[model samples]
Target: MLQASFGSQHPSSDARKVADWALRSHDNRQAAFIIIDKRAARLYVLDEAGRLRGSTSVLLGAAHGDDTVPGIGQRAISEVRPGERTTPAGRFLAERGHNGRGEDVVWVDYDAGVSIHRVLTSNPGERRLARLASPVLADKRISYGCINVPVAFYETYIRPMFARQPAMVYVLPEVKSVDEVFAMAASPQR
Candidate 1:
């Protein structure tokens, strides 16, 4: 494992680059931050000091786009089409919140109904848990828009870190350049 910033082992270059940039820029403002690498289907949780708190495989949107469909969040789940389901890529100030079922979640994009919560096993057909364990990247893409993480990871790392405070969540884009998504790329170096 390649040792990156703050003792984190990042297997993907995109994830490492984003984490390094965020720390170098103080973009997180000393708050804990999360980097969700879409290509790798991995989630890295870091503390305020850029220390890796935990890492895990996660489930993302079924589609392979970076922008959310207009008014998709406002639409009922049954009304959302497959193509419209996307997890917009960018930096999000996420906070602890509850979903419709009163389950706690880290609200990534509240208006877009994009949040990071425990994996949903309600549908046996989805095979969310199995997909998470699968080696194929395609198997991981099976969520409406929200991010699904393991239950233990949620309780051990995510819940405790954001239970009382909001944090930054940088979701790497699969279709757009990082510079296009993050304005910090255009700013002068510190």
Candidate 2:
């Protein structure tokens, strides 16, 4: 709507609604915005004016859901159950920061300890990288509620936009209705 071009058409109406609403309503339209489609296992990046910068496959939580345990973020991974591993759906004001491992990441839900980082290829059994490359998005769910993307994509697009300025993130809901998770007035029909 701002004379900018959008690249991916994969985001559902819910995701697109939230992104559009943010661009039109949020005061800081100059900053970057991101939309993560959990159902699609895709990440969409856009400029402040709503033009798509790039998009790529991503890995999400192993389980499917839109809510996280109240204090699961602080618990050790070993103690967390499989079903509890979920990426919450909502709007997040993401910022860039370094994790304990000294690797750069974009914290989407800080309180939930959810962040977007380069895909980890250390665990060959998990086949994380292979999952991301799979044509079926359902294969991409193998992380611990964190979003894992390609290293080049993160360094090239995500880090630059979020490292300097805060960005908006909309994680589309998979188990709940968009209205239930994000009550923003949806974009008007074309």
Q: What is the C-alpha RMSD of each candidate to the true structure, in Å?
A: 3.3, 3.7
Candidate with maximal lDDT:
1
> What's the TM for model 1?
0.92
Best by TM-score: 1
Would you give me the overall lDDT of model 2?
Answer: 0.82
Write the residue-wise lDDT of candidate 2 on 69-165 in tens digits. Answer: 8998788888888898898888787899877689889998777789999999988999987898999877988888999999999989998988668
Model 2 TM-score is: 0.91
Residue 139 displacement (Å), model 1: 0.3
The residue-by-residue lDDT of candidate 1 on 14-109, one tens digit each, is 777777777777888767889998988989988777778788999999999999987888988999899877878988888999999999999999
Q: Name every residue pair that clashes in candidate 1.
A: none
